[model samples]
Target: MTVSVLICDDSNIARKQLKKALPEQWKESALLVNNGEEALEALQMGNFDLLFLDLTMPVMDGFQVLAAIKEQGIQVKTIVVSADLQIEARNKVAADGAIDFIRKPVSASALLDVLNTHGLL
Candidate 1:
């Protein structure tokens, strides 16, 4: 099965970096969005296997997105990608149903690690 992924971040550079770091097979199926609001819209329209989300963003943040996903019962698995490395933020995302969290600046290995741990790679 082709695993579709949605990458949501405010920084264009960050989005590009994440997309580039994805496995070659997954890159073809990856979708990029600028923020959580856009991520939600995309989620509503398509079924994505994974979500690479940024914590701080304009319009809507990753925390809000995670809460919305849980409240609305969205099925995609989420891995938060954030510059914030605080324990509180990590715990919040974890509590909100994110499978994993990656601290920024993200590396190819980090992406691979999260994917592998979650059996998405």
Candidate 2:
């Protein structure tokens, strides 16, 4: 099965980096968004297998996005990818129902590991 992913990050560079790092097999199935608001909009528009979300953003933040998703009962799984590696950040995101947490500047192997762990590969 092809896994559809929504990537939310404020940095264009970060988005490009993620796009470049994702396995080529998943390229065509990925959707990139610039902020939490856009991510939420995309989620409401289509069915996605997973979400790669950044913690800090302008219009909205990852925490707010996750909370909104949970509040709306959206069922897509999410992996938090952020530069902030604070224990409290992880705990909060986890409490908000993120499936996993990945540090920023993520490597291809790390991304793959997450996908594999979630059985999305």
* Top-lDDT candidate index: 1
Each model's TM-score? 0.97, 0.96
lDDT of 2 by residue, 21-71 (tens): 788877888999999999999999999988999999999999999999999
For model 1 the local lDDT of residue 41 reads 96
TM-score of candidate 2 versus the correct structure, residues matched by position: 0.96
How good is model 1 by TM-score?
Answer: 0.97
Which regions of candidate 1 fall more than 4 Å away from where they truly are?
Answer: none
C-alpha lDDT values of all predictions: 0.93, 0.91
Per model, how many backbone clashes are there?
0, 0
Worst 10 residues of 2 by lDDT: 18-27
Error of 1 at 95 (Å): 0.3
Stretches of model 2 off by over 4 angstroms after superposition: none
Kindly give the stretch of ten consecutive residues in candidate 1 with the minimal lDDT sum.
112-121
lDDT by residue (1-121, candidate 1, tens digit) is 4789999999999999999999988888899999999999999999998999999999999999999999999999999999999999999999999999998888999888888898886
